[model samples]
Target chain A: MVLMFKIFKNGWLDIFAALKGYELAGVLGWQDIRQRYRRSSLGPFWLTISMGVLIGALGLVFGNLFASPMKEFLPFLTIGLILWTLITTAVNEGCTGFTAAEAMIKQISLPLFTHILRVLWRNLIIFAHNLVVFPLILLVFGVPLPATALLAIVGLVLLILNLSWMMLLLGVFCTRYRDVPQIITNLLQVCFYLTPIIWMPNLLPKRASILLLHANPFFHLIEIVRAPLLGTLPSALSWQVGIVLAIAGWVFTIIFYGRFRSRIAYWL
Target chain B: MTNILINNLCVEFPIYNSTTGRSLKNHLMQAVTGGLMGSNEQGHVVVKALHNICLDLKEGDRLGVLGHNGAGKSTLLRVISGVYAPIGGSIVVNGKVTSLIGLSLGMDSEATGIENIYLRGALLGFNRSWLSSKVKEIVDFAGIGDFIEMPLRTYSTGMQMRLAFSIATMQQPEILVMDEWLTVGDADFQEKAQQRLQEIISKTSILVIATHSPELVERVCNKMIRLERGALIAA
Candidate 1:
């Protein structure tokens, strides 16, 4: 109830700030994205080319190593790699959000939360670009593009909503702890193996697969999201777990963000 | 009363000691041989930039600031700008405050001088058409020849200050905060800058200038505050 009122009071200011941040992020995204490929002949096509090669290499090597077919495996790995980049970029940048904005924070009286939101919004723009490669890879691999393709748009919305609060919570906590990002990085590296992104879920036995589906939020976020993009939406039960985790992530992040949002400047 | 209430403020600056690298071999060597002693000492003791400070300013107050080297003038400007958060005490501010202490530093180095004026203006909460309509006035006041279209990095310091001063003064905020460095420049801009400042002084509700110069303090300020060792001294 207290949080509700606080948001209500500061709602207009926060929204205006976020809008300003989004505009700035779009400009910054253009620069960052362009600079990375400025001298390269292919420019943004490099993203598509590099991702295609990465998916191909991983599918060939890892697929052969694990005795999986290269055809179906390519689509799975391509979607997984794209999603992985988004998660990694958001988490890593979110961790250092305060430090990067230290100059702006010190110079202006604007809210510190603006910096975190700006960084996340920029990463989201990049994610949008990388997502272009996902469908192309799926199409090239002879997958049927279905009417459920609209689910990808919904998933993107959920991803942003869920990640926004996660960013606030993690951004604040990381500033205070300083070691939190490192710990999270280490944990995320391990999660990659157990989450079954590169590997299909059916490969696991019934019990283990269901357990992984329920317990691992990343898997569910990706699985539910990639399900439509990969031509396979999750069952309603799977959707339950994904939707619940997404809501829970927002709740947890918001609570932490609310507690420390006012104190972040001092921490930095 | 339109006043600013400031309690204790302490800002610490940390300079990392790179004498000892972070490699494990350095750790092992330090365990046995202690790579460098100064690195360890500098590592722990932070420079107490501002100790405990308390003050209040009323409406129509033109307060002159004085301090020495390593004095917290810039830090104080930063704190009031909402850049540096005070470690202790509470600050109550009334009305809109415009800070021009590091005006040029915030200008985008890659952008044209004219474009940077708008960028900096937007950062200060001005809208598009507002800056658009005011662009020519800002450019005329800056007094830069033809270089307004060039990147800021290409301009001379005096040229940069011309643009900076123009942008900084664009908003005649209720409270205007400035650093003493505003007085340092070529004579041409100085004479014009002084006239502009005088015009602003009479109109502004509150003006706080940090300077070691008694002339700057006495001529422009009706009130004075001296700081020593992070505490206020009687004027």
Candidate 2:
């Protein structure tokens, strides 16, 4: 019991110390984006442009195929894809958060949590860039701003909280097992189709939709934000699921992270 | 009052082979079979990097760690720097610690020299305001005229080292840890760097350095210990 207490204390302290280094994480995060597109004339707008093209192309093809009207379908698809990208990129990058900083990890003693924050921050920046397409989509599709849109901020905060834990857990695991990254990438690919990013969840009959969509944790995660941004309040189920997942995920992650946080440098 | 108290510290590395050792499949199979298949598959190898080491360093102590390659010198320094948590025993450190082990680890080649000052400085735990205050001094000490405005990749190796060395020594640490004496830049800069390094070492309350050079230990450190195959052999 004493050992467990010590682990929890150290884990919490690691996070608290890392929080003091947020400026370092933020700068490194911006550098990742800037370095990736250094020579390009358009710079990070390239992220905006590519995501815009994908949303435009997919919106037209999928909207016609599903026979959903363009007015509602485009905004739904836009928000869904944007949030999905944020989730997947954060997870994928998290797998390398420790391993990628092998030099810094071995040589210096920065808090391990700082690397996880860097991954999340980088993906968040990318998510912000991709979000630039949303306002443009709203303009083109003539979607009205709704008061429910403010709720998306709460959803976003919850989503970030959930992603942070996932990143910490995956970062520790992936550092130890080299093959875990490939497994994660493949699993996320499968999840992309399983989740309703491109398709409308309402397509299914009422009973089936409720069972399938409500059961999917990813659907709720995306819905909490996407639903609010699309001018409708998310169902209480979505908010409940989001809150429950955040708490449960953090609880599990803190224990796991605390248990193995010290061993991360050795694994790398 | 700055000190480092380590008691019977042990550090071990689990050396994982590519195929079976570090794979999720192997771990799952182990869970399923228990010890049935343990003999055939080569189990993970564990290398003892540091074994039952105890040391106490107080203020104004300059301790040199002398070891041959693979003798755990780097590992010991890492443990002292708080990078590697000892698998056994405890270490109580009562001072702010700074490591000069990898001076250029976080630097960005795509970033200009001035930007890298902030980048590397922040990685070393210096805040933006402090870094901003020292930017001009670091730039001047580095003496890479006008290169500060250009991307670091454009600078030659010596210029890069100069900038890295300057930024790394900007702060006075309570406990300073180093892997070796740094020899940076051309002869002129090397002389200047040596002087700056000596100044920092003198000001730091406790110094831990690992080096192969006995001459460096004799010239600088007040105490010295030698290690062989992860065990302390002499003091």
Candidate 3:
């Protein structure tokens, strides 16, 4: 019980301290984007352009193949792909949150959560860049702006909350076991197909769709944002799943982080 | 007032090599075989970086640490800086601490000298207003001139070090921890750098520096200790 209390304190306090360092994380995150796109004339817009090209091509082939109208299918596919990109990239990069910051971790005494925030914030910037494609897709397809679209912000907040905990957990775990990152990359690759990004969940029969969509947490995460933006309220089930995952994941992460927080620098 | 109270502090590092130590496969195999294969496998190696160390530092104290390579000098400094938490003991630190262990740790080579000033300063916990107020002074002291607008990668090694040194010493920390005495740039700049460093050290409440040069410790420190293989041997 005493050990549990210690772990709770260690994990939560690190997060509280890290919240105060958002400015540091923000600057570092922006620098990461700038550094990656340095000397390129298009800068980070290249993210939007490449994503735009992929969405366009996939929309063309898949829309025709699925025999859905371009107007209806394009917006759905666009939103799905954008949210999927955020989830996949965030998790992939999350695996390296501690290792990539090895220099800063070993030398400085900044809150360890600050590194996790840096990774999330960096991906959010890329997510924002990719979001540019969404507006264009809406404009071209003439998808009417729906009142439910504003809820995407709330959905995004929930999604970010969920991703943050995953990053924290994976960041600490991957630091100790070097092989986990590779395993995670391969798993996420498999998950991309398992989760509905390019394909529509409606394509499956009702029973199969329910089983696949409800059981897979990523589907609920994506649907929370994508559903609202694509002109429908997310099912009550999606919100319930998202909220539960956020709370549960954070509880587990806090305990895991507290137990292992002190060991991260050693692992690195 | 500034104080650093440490008691029976211990730090151990588990060195996980690539082969058997850091792989999930080995761990799973060990679990499957129970204790059967665990004995033969070369598990992770643990290095006791710091052991049963105790020290008390107060305001107006200048403590120098002397040791050869891998004698835990750097680890000791890091523990004080709050980078590595103690595994088996307790440490209570009051007052803000700044470490000049790696002056260029967070600097970005792709960024301009001016941009790196903010980046590195933010890592050191300075807010934007504070950094904005001191940007001109940092630039002037670094002496990079027109190159301040150019990317850091364009700067020569001495120029980069000078800029890093200037940004690192801009704030007067209550507890100043350093790995070594920073002497950088050409002869003229070295004189200026030393003067700046001395000025900061004099105003600092507590100074903890690790170095090999006995002459440096004699010149700068009033109290000194020596560590041999993670154990304090002399004081």
lDDT of 3 by residue, A1-268 (tens): 8988889888999999999879999999999999999999999999999999999999989999988888888888888888988988898789899999999989998889999999999999999999999889989977777888999999999999999999899989999888998999898888888888878887888888876788989999999999889888999999999999999999999999999998899888
Q: In model 2, which runs have C-alpha deviations exceeding 4 angstroms?
A: B18-43
Give each candidate's interface RMSD in Å.
3.7, 0.9, 0.8
Order candidates by lDDT, high to low.
3, 2, 1
lDDT of model 1, residue A191: 84
Q: What is the docking quality class of candidate 1?
A: acceptable
Candidate 3: regions farther than 4 A off: B18-43
Ranking 2 against 3 by lDDT, winner: 3
Comparing 1 with 2 on TM-score, the higher-scoring candidate is 2
Model 2 score (lDDT): 0.88
Residue-wise C-alpha lDDT for candidate 1, range A33-125, written one tens digit per residue? 554665578777776777777777888888987788766787788778888878877878888888777676766777566666667767776
Best model number under DockQ:
3
